[model samples]
Target: MSTPSADESVELEWDDIQSGALHERPSPYVGRYVLIRIDDREAGRELVRRLLPAIEAGHPTADPARDAWITVAFTYQGLRALGVPSDSLDSFAPEFRAGMAARAAELGDVGDSDPGNWEQPLGTPAVHIALAALSPDSVRLAKVMERAQQAYGQLPGVEVIWRQDCYQLETGRTSFGFRDGIGQPAVEGTGRNTNPHEAPIKAGEFLLGYPDETGALPPMPSPDVLGRNGTYLVFRKLHTRVAAYRQYLYDQASSRAEERLLAAKTVGRWPSGAPLSLSSDQDDPELGADPDRNNRFSYHDDLDGFKCPAGAHARRANPRGALDHENSVNVRLHRMIRRSTSYGPSLPEGVREDDGADRGIVFVCVGAHLKRQFEFVKTQWLNDGIFIGAPQEADPLVGRSDTPGVFTIPRRPVRRRLRNLPPFVVTRGGEYFFVPGLRALRWLSELDS
Candidate 1:
C-alpha cells in the first residue's frame, strides 16, 4: 500500500466550510434536531434564502461562547423538492440517491432495521431537510429553536415533522455505560489534532474539493461552489437496550471484576474510555481523561488480540493497524468522523434492571465518499466478520443477529468465546443528508428553478 505524502502544511478555511459536524468538535451540552419536509419548491427556496445568514459556518468563533450555533443539511429528495436542477441532482453519490432505507439490507437492518419499523418521517420520502441547533445549556438551545421556528413560520411550505433533543449525561457515558465519543479521527487541515501518531487524513476524505486518500478529488456535485467543502452525512437513531445489555454482562461473567473486564474486552475500551490496548489489566480513569494518552495507543503492539480482542467493537470499527495485512495507510482510507450525541433519558446510574425507557444515541457519521468510508464500514467492517479474520462473529456491541452472535476473547492457553449474543441495540430510524458549505447554502438558495 502506498502512503500519501504527509501534508502537514495544509490549512483549512474555517470560514468557508460549514459548521462541519465532522470536525468542528462542538461538544454542545444540549442540542435539538429537527426533521423537515418541503411542501412547495418555490417556498422552500425562499425559506433557504431567508435563513442562509443564520446558518453557522465552520469558523471556530462562529458561535458565541454563551449562545447557540445552527447548521442545516438536506437529503437527496429534499434537494429535489427544493427544485435543484436535474444535472446537479444527478451528481450526488448513488447511495445518497438511493436513500438510506433502500440500502437497509446491506447495512444489516433487515429485521428490526426494516424501514417499516422506522419512525414516520425517517425512512419515508417525507423527510427532506434536517436542522440542528447546539448550545451550552437548555435555555440557549430553546432560544435557538425559537429562532428556527420563527424563521420557518414565515415559510408555510416547510414543515417540521419530528424533533429529537439530546444532552450529555453527567457521567459522560452512553446508555450502555461506556464512555462515548472518545475515539475520533483527526482530519488533515482541521487544526484539531488528537493523537500524535495517527496520521492526518486528507481533507477530501471528509470534505469536498480537497485531495482524498487516493490523492484525487472525490466526485463532487455540479456547480463548483455548491459542492466545495460540502460532505455527506449518515444520521441514525439507535436505541440501546440498557437493561438487556447489563443483564448480559452479568450472566456472562463469573464475578464483578470479570464482568467489568468482559465489558472492556467486548468494547475494546474500559468504561472510563481508556483503550484495552493501553490499560489491559484495569480501567484507568486518569488515562481515559487524558485525551493525549487515551487515543494515542494503537493496535500495532497487540497484533494477536491478546491485550485487545481482534473482534472488539472499536477494533472492528477501526482496526488502526491491527489488521493482519498491517497496512495503516489502507486503513486510513476508510476512516470517518463521528459527531454522535446521546438522546432520551439517561438510565439511573448503577441500576441493572430495565427501566423500559427509550434512550440511545443520535449517531451522525460524516464523510466525503459515502461508499468507501461510511457504507463500507457499516456493511463490511461493523456488520461482517470476514475483514478481521472472524468469519462468523459480528460486532459484540452493535452487530445484529437473529439466532446468536459470537465474541472471541483471545487469552493465553485457551481462547474464550461468548456465544448466543443477542442484539443490544436497535435502529429506530435513519436518513442520508448532504451537509453543504455556507457558500453552497447560498448557491442553493439562489438556484434557478
Candidate 2:
C-alpha cells in the first residue's frame, strides 16, 4: 500500500455528505445522543423521511446554522427492521453486522466491561437508530432537539429508548482532567490541515467513494445512493471512576509536581492538553492553547521513550512518526475521526472520595472501514501493546485490565514502571451505526413501503 500523497486532489460532494464529516466542533459546546428502536417498517421509514429535511450537508464552523442540526445512523438490525433487502444488508462489514456487543471479547471488553453488563437497549438489537444533535449553547441545542423530537415524537412503532446529554466543561477537560479532542486529522480534500508535520490524509479514509491511503476506493455497502457518500460511526458511553483515578495518582506521587508529571505520563499529555512530546518536563499552558503547535510534535525522535513513554495513552493511540521503523505498521490506516464529549458532572478538584455520580465521556468516531480504523485501534493498540514492545501492558487509561497490569515509563538512567494498574474506564454501553449521506437518507425513506 502507498502513503497518502499530497499531490492528489479530489473534490468531494459536500452537499451529499453528513455535516459531521467536515464539522470542526467548537469548545464549550453542548450535545445530545438519542437511541431509538423500530417495531414497524413503515414507521421507521417515515421517521427517516421526517428527519431528512433537518439533516443537511456539511457546513462551515462559522455558519450559525451549523451549531443546531441533527445527524442519524442505523445499526445492522436497524436496516433489516427498515425492510432493506437481504443482499444489501449482507454487504456490510461482518463486525458491524455482528454488532459491537458480539465483538466484545475481541475488543477486550471482558470482566466488568463485558457486554452482559452493558446498559439496556445499547448492546441489544432494539437499538436501530442513533441521532446526535449539537450546538455551542443550550438554547440553540434546544431548538434543534425540539425539531428532532417532533421528527419521531408521534411516529408509531418508532420508540426513543435512551439518550445522553454531554458537553465540554468550563475547564475544557474530561472527567479524567485531561484536555480532550486534540490531534484531529485533516482530510485531503478539506482545507483544514492543522498539523504542519503531516500531509492531509486521503479523503476516503473517513468518507466513501474516494481513494484511501491504500490507493483504492474503500468497500461501500450495496446500492450507490445508500453507501456512496456514507460512512460508519462508533458511539460509546464510558463510565469513569473519577475518585479512583484521583486517589491512585495521589498515592503514586509524593508532591503536587510529581502528581502532575505522573498524570501527563499516564495520558501522554498534561491537563492543559500540551503533549509530553513538546513539553516533557513541565506543563505549558500556552503551548497547549496554541492549536498550530500543540499537535505538531511526533514520537519518532523519542524512540527510547525518554520524552513520551511508548505505552502512554496518546502514543499508543496514534504512534504517528514512531512506527516508521516497523515493517507492516501504517499509522495512517488506523486513524479515525474522534470527537468525544464528557457526560455527567465534572468531579470537583482534589476530591478523592467516591461520589457515586455516573460521569465519563461519550466517544464518537467516524470512518469508512470499521474493521481497519476503529476495531484495529481498539484491539491492537488499546487492548494490547505488542506493537509498542510491551505485550502485557494495555492502555493505562481505558484498557480493560482484568488482572493488574503494568505501565512502563522510560527515565534518564533507569526506567520507571508502574505496576498493578487497574482498569480506570468501564464500558457502560456502546453501538455501531452506519451514518449515511443526505441522498442515502432519501433512499432509505423512499424504500418500498
Maximum-TM-score candidate = 2
Q: Which stretches of candidate 1 lie over 4 Å from their true place?
A: 1-6, 26-28, 62-67, 324-329
Task: Encode model 2's per-residue lDDT on 32-88: one tens digit a residue.
Answer: 999999999999999998898778696445553446667789999999999988989
TM-score of each: 0.94, 0.97
Q: Model-by-model lDDT, in order?
A: 0.82, 0.86
| Model 1 per-residue lDDT tens digits across residues 1-449 | 23233456766767777664553434547888899889998778887877777776654553434557777889999999988889999999999999999988888886766778887778789999899877778888888777778778757888889999898777678877888777677778766555556677888898898889898999999888878889999999998888787888899989999989998998999988999988899999999888777877678778789999988999988988776364433888888888788988888865778788889999988999999898888778888888777888889877865447899999989999999888888889898999988888888888777
User: Residue pairs in steric clash, candidate 1?
Assistant: none
TM-score of model 1 vs. true structure: 0.94
